[model samples]
Target chain A: MTDVDPIALAVFLFFFLLVTVLGFLAAKWRRGDTLDSLDEWGLGGRGFGTFIAWFLIGGDIYTAYTFIAVPALLYAGSVVGFFAVPYTIVLYPIIFIFLPRLWSVSHRHGYVTPADFIRGRFDSRPLALAVAVTGILATMPYIALQLVGIQVVLEVMGIGGAEDASWFVKDIPLFLAFAILAAYTYASGLRAPALIAFVKDTLIYLVIIVAVFYLPTQLGGWDSIFAAASDSFDAFNTENADAIAAGEVSGKGAIPPGAAHWAYASLALGSALALFMYPHSLTGVLATKNRSVIRRNAALLPAYSFLLGLLALLGFAAIAAGITVDNPQQAVPALFESQFPGWFAGIAFAAIAIGALVPAAIMSIAAANLWTRNVYKAFLKPDATPAQEAKQSKLMSLLVKFGALFFVLGLPLELAINLQLLGGVWILQTFPAIVFGLYTRWFHRHALFAGWAVGMIYGTWTAYNVPAVGDPDSHFGSPVATVPFLDIDIYIALTAFVFNVLVALAGTLLLNAMNVDGGGDLTSPDDYKADAGDVGVKDLPLDEMAPGEVAKGTP
Target chain B: MPDSTRGSRNTRPVWLLVALLLAVAIAVPLLVPLYDRATPTFLGFPFFYWFQFMLIPIASVLTYTAFKLSQAATRHDRAARGQKPPAGERGGVS
Candidate 1:
């Protein structure tokens, strides 16, 4: 790496080291009675108030990749990139509708993971296992995308690699970053991200506020910015006219036409449905102190969505400023580096890096919680103690981070993005089992499992067959596909989800009609209403009820 | 598990109104073609961009209103059941 700016690099490292120290010390910041329980390590003792939960969940949802990639997509594609805006706007209401119930039931049962709730709701170990496994699978690529975000920043800073640098040399900075992250996450579970999120989010907000207000002035005004962006897109369309005419690449414009409307809508809707189902998102929700915290935050968290809208405008600003990068993912960072002073650029870079760290820590913790509770404790050793579970979760968190590190370092970045796209498709399959299961037990566990299998297989196959423009022979290239009997292209995830629900409904009916024994429900309907400070329920013993007996007559 | 408080007061209206608000918040943006245009601009933002940004606060206020209504319903339920409302429920937006 040549001509690296020492001032910017030093400033970036200063904030990085500061957050690393805070991450390690956070283990003791809110020390619980004991660190031996999954409750303490995995969910921050299940005691985060509304304020902390707001920052933590906000930090988790709006990641470095989002800060970078959303604007990048806007810079590259135009209107379709704005799908993120509507999706995030709609997400809170969806979360408002269902998440409190999840928090209540999970709190009542002392559930550490979504799978635990599934197991309790459906009385099926396999269905819970499916939820847990899908969570991990979907999360790994997402974590890798975070690393890709970090890599973009590092590459922009000229610290990571050169054209012919060896892989080890190229990835040394990434490995170092991951090493520090894994160390703190191992020492302090969800607490690290919970604490670090404060710093990360503050930096993000400051950077965006400054960038949104300041950057536009530097490159004329908003009108010129939009005009420049429009010009660049027009130029790109002209350059790629053949591909556009052949329907290989999407047409470029600030607004999409009638034909592309379904693709945009389905993407926004499908992503909104899938966002909260991510294990890390739920982990943040479940960690809150009460049902009101969930409700209040659902109301309050749209502040980030507003901030995200401002951030997305930076894409047009980047085009107006004439910023260019080999990878469009680097557009935002490259814009900051080009426009801002050295120290401010350093702060912006630190914001992006810490952005990666917060979500990475939370995601690994969530994935670790899933693996420990569902796979290790459920299938491997049913009698594992809370202490044992805590220890296993700590270790598994490291493995999960390293696995994401390997994914970014070992594979092409395009593949990482593709895998995360597939992840979005895959995670939506669990909605029928988890989100639907929250409201009803009418869905047979075996049928839900079968539905999950069908959705997973069908979604993967359809995604694999869709060819990417310009990158011939690549599979899983786009999330949109034509409906089976109709000539319309829509999000494959929503289509597969429909198939999942229909199959699940049919199977539930047939199974019930055949007198198949639907497994016993472990949670009472009242458990869905229990909130923090509720008497008796919070202290319910893990095995207070027998395997199939619901808690009856409890008031 | 049948509690007297939940059954004593009617909360269906509050919940139905909240559901209606949320439905509108979610539906307006998903019907993409309606706002996918450039003519109507706010501070140089095209309709596609500004329309979604405007929905953020509208969604938030609707959610907050729903939260307050639900809280009010809970308080009403407690009073109807001849029980003292929890200390935390005594004051706030309501």
Candidate 2:
């Protein structure tokens, strides 16, 4: 293979070093602030305003998952792939509805993680542990997905490794990048990602805007781009008509055909419901200055969806530009390389790599927060000091990253993607406990725990049975499956969610009949309405909590 | 125990309207059959493509409107509870 281009490598390394320096310096972003507690390290002192909160959340949402995963769908001609656009549009409104209550209650109770919120709200340590373990397990593959995004960009630049390079050598760049990220996140906590988000997002928006408006012009125009994509799909379908008839492959299309209508809609609805259920997404909300900041961001963040909608279409732009690659994930990066100059293309590559880092940092931190708050404090050391808790979170963040690195280095990428699909399903199983607890305490903790367990098993089993197309023996092939009796294809997560709610409802009714004592509610109604200046709504870290403070604050 | 009875005490019609606005914004885009067409093209864009892009602004305006309504409703709720109005409503940091 040819050596990597000197000019592009220089430019990419320049921005990479710049972001590394910025990440290390972010330990001091807030002057005189000490990284001594979960509140400061895990949630960035819980003081980010509307602007910084917007970038941080945007950094999480507009991630490699957005830039790479979404476009690769359209490039590969998956009809249901465009479901991502509607998925995001539906997400903000859901956020506008439920997230404020979560923020308010979390502020009132010194909760550093969602599991902490569950422990306080439901007072069931076992149920909270269930939630915490699910969050950590689900997030590990998500972080690996981000590493895949960066690896794709590096491969396009020819810096990752040559075609036949050894696996360890092929992944050295990712290892170096993750090492720096782990170090800075340990030092500054959430603040490192929160600060670097400002740079990463700006570069990303510039690259997308330039590529969206400029690429179509270079490849004829939007009309021809659409036409070219449609024509390409038609030719592919004709060539593979025999395989399509045998169900060995899915048909290529620009939009959902009649049968896929439910698949598209259910995917949108299901992902919208699952998005906020992710611990990393909530880490952004809890870090905001107050409840209003979350609402304001919910409204303002749709601007990124508009940008994302445009970016997803770059897959079609690749078609019209005649950019072809065996792996569809390589199309967009290869587009930037062939279409843009060496220098600007290097800048774009750097942006994508850095973009992946933001969510990777946030996801590991969220997972670590769960381990420290729910598993460690709840079970091992009931009276662990705040300093000790922060130390635990920092170390756990490293361990979590190493676990994700195992997924990247030790396993195949497709297996990781399939597990990430299940991750979405498993995380959504916590919705009954979390979102319901935000509104009412009616659902018994035991009932919710049972629902989570049932949903997780059913979802995993169903997802495991869906055979891969073109190879009828493999499983975890798709996220959608046919409904049992209704016989329409829909997202497996939504179906599992329906089962979860029904089981929780029936179990709660039975428990209420028996008068089985729900441990106790540690929160009051006012806790859901409290804000920054409200009584007992102090923004103190858990380590700062004095003895009997939780007991005293309950009323 | 005292706060448990006040679930609806601070509730306002604006809050109801906020929920309505957000619900519509969320549900309208998920109704795939409504705009899943390629016949009508705008600026060389299919109806399916442009319509979803258009929903972005339509949803934004609705959500922005909901943001303001919630801000006002929250102020009224705080005032009713004998507390100061929430900060950061007028671009002020908390």
Alpha carbon lDDT of each predicted model:
0.73, 0.76
- The lowest-lDDT stretch of 10 consecutive residues in candidate 1 chain A is A546-555
Clashes of 1: 0
**What lDDT tens digits, residue by residue, belong to model 2 across residues A101-209?**
8888988888857788899999998899999898888778678777777777777887666657896787766776677567655665555554555677678777877
Among these predictions, the greatest lDDT belongs to: 2
For model 2, what is the error of residue B29's alpha carbon versus the real structure, in angstroms, after optimal superposition?
Answer: 0.6
Candidate 1: residue pairs that collide: none
In model 2 chain A, the worst 10-residue window by lDDT is: A546-555
Task: Score candidate 1 by DockQ.
Answer: 0.59
Each candidate's fnat: 0.72, 0.63
Count of clashing residue pairs in every prediction? 0, 2
